[model samples]
Target: MGPGAGEVSWRHWICDARDGRLICPIDIPSFSWDMGIGDFGFSTTDKGAGKIDESGLTLPWAAIPASTPDERSAMLDSQRRAIVTTWAASDDPEDKGTPLFWGKITGRDDTWLDTSFGLESPMAILSSRYAVRDGAFKDGHSSDSIAFTGMSYRGICSELGRIATDGKQGGELPFDWTYTGERGSHDRTDYQAWNVQNLAVDQLLTNIANCQGGPDIAFRPYWADEQHIRVRFLAGSDADVYLDMDHSPVCLSSFPDGGSLEDIHVSYQDGYHRWYATGAGTDQGTLTCYVESMAPITQSMDPPVLREAVYGDTDTDNLDLLRRHVGGVAQNNSGKLMQITGSIDFGDTDQFGVPLHPLGSMWPGESVTLSIAGFPTLPDGDYGLRLMEMSGDQGSKADLKFDVLEAPFQ
Candidate 1:
């Protein structure tokens, strides 16, 4: 029989994180993945929580053994990993299925008939390792300082990833690592310099990527073969501009001519009106910038409430760059930012009848332009989809949460 419409098939595989060797396959009856770039749709806090996908799964007790050393190692407690692949019901299983997630097993719960495991994206795994110090204690001088002199953002992340994986940096990691995409120009002088001390690999990477005008970074997985699953580093400021997805510029309009979005809810936060930023140097020599909002929201405050913030960058000494950095930060957080949450029904189509594949079409850090009727506060323009919380089981619609892209006062 042909597969029914809206039917989706899922497959799970437990693999050795070190070498990507297939450890075992299990039938996961149900699972949900919540993946995104930042904390859930909040504009004020640090958005450096880079692509930390989280999920939980339950498996039959017989699927993975407890006594076998290899199987036990493959279990969540041993820091092994799992990959989830899915496809349309009609697609042949012999073909390579789309890899939805690849994460390390972090926690576990066991019962007589079933066991549940917690899975987190690669950033969570990297967080466990710290950025290696520049020189060992045995090497005469020991320093926690790591320097990036005029290096592109992509190069910085690549170096940090290498430091985390290569034993020479600290200890060799089992899994392979590689990065792709470019951020700044190849001109050495064009890139900025940065120095960090005693930071975790994940923290260092996020701090760099979340800076003013930084590119988006994601840990993406690709199916290699039965024995290997490949994960690649993707970083780019204009990543989506290269895609040719026909459904893009997808409109979620309530107007008669367009398709409608369901369960639309909007909330706003009181963002800071004044920003004070310090970079490099100490005492009176520090480079600093201070700016206050002149936006509509700030002006509307009856008594003109003053919300202030202080920011620090450890490596930049250029005063102009520091000003630009604080300027961008102030612009993003100066007004009341809107946080929108909604869902698109499975098998739904856009106004032009293009099938809406929420997960397939849009990703975190990509841009989406839409218009809603009731919320005239949000102008019809470009908005960034910074965080996506996708949760569903089997054949179900995925819930989506989009954090504010820009200040609404604009």
Candidate 2:
């Protein structure tokens, strides 16, 4: 079964990020969210390739009531000290809402016809802190590199996440997270080490996740109550690839004759046969690892095409970590760069007037099936929902623009 079709309404609130307390409720006439699950690049040199999800919306000055000059000024501040909470509920009489977006304000547009603001996911907040050496605050060398030895990549990400949201730097963010899924072979090896120095928390996390055996990363927002908004950070080995047929099957098909589909694009990225990566240290002591693709095509080549690239991070001295990082690039890029993109109506209905797929039907990291008959070359079966953008206004259905990946079978 696919997502339920229905009508939904929205509500917006202005809130404090330090305490998740709602400051006031404002009617948001329209809004849009460009949510991303993970890195979309194929190169290893993409250092700051971490996903920085974002949203944009306009607010009229008259949306809120302010009795004093100070009150009005505080409500319009665009320094990201405050956050916006978006909620959606079925048009049912009960109106049980589901928190949709919780992002920190990063920019404003008072110069526009209506005051508009740009917002970013918690990653923007996480980018505020530098990955200082653990316990560097007590030591005089606060800028020295920090190292994690014998811990899994998941452990490293969790520790960094905690440090970013922990109140040590100042007040903590209104966020929480958990690490779920299988542990990799590098989870607890004494000889392995991961190091960081003076890098933003978000960048460092992305570097780790993009490594050979790194976990998939994603963020979600939740409404604890009418007065609070909470954000969650999710990371795991198989976090985004799981398939639950009962609830996860989202069937989207466009017949060759006619359908509401307006546009579609299919693109592919080149893959590399040989991969190499460098880690921390320099001179003769600098650590490095290399791997070649096992893909049949690469093996069948007469000269074995030497497509080489350097990917992953340079903060680790662990040879195992470096090997996995480069190997992952080869594994993922071995002729499997097919990506599909299109726009779909979240409120479309069948001849019987039944909703086809409603808003909130799918999310980043989930899988959806597309049977696009017009494109005969398009692969069949499920594809990973890499990114999804939902845009709409107060009383209408949303339009979703999505990017999906079809992994090449080994």
Which pairs clash in model 2? 44-311, 212-324, 212-325
Which tens-of-lDDT digit does each residue in 1-410 have in candidate 2? Answer: 12233454565667776767878767654443445563211100112453222325555567755655577667756653465544343556345366656766656666423556566567776777665534555533333444455566666776667755673656377776565232444442221112333367788777777775576676666767756777776665433333233364566665565544436666666666766677777778778777776565545644434466776466666787677667766777765466666666655667875656655556655556665665666555444453344444343444445553534532
lDDT of 2 at 122: 70
TM-score: model 1 vs. ground truth: 0.72
Error of 2 at 366 (Å): 0.2
Global lDDT scores for all candidate models: 0.56, 0.57
Residue 372, candidate 2: alpha-carbon lDDT: 61
Question: Candidate 1: deviation at residue 59, Å?
Answer: 3.7
Per-candidate TM-scores read: 0.72, 0.74
Q: Candidate 1 residues 102-214, lDDT tens each?
A: 76665676777766666656787777765564343334444434455545666667766776676454354443444422334422121211222435677766765656655
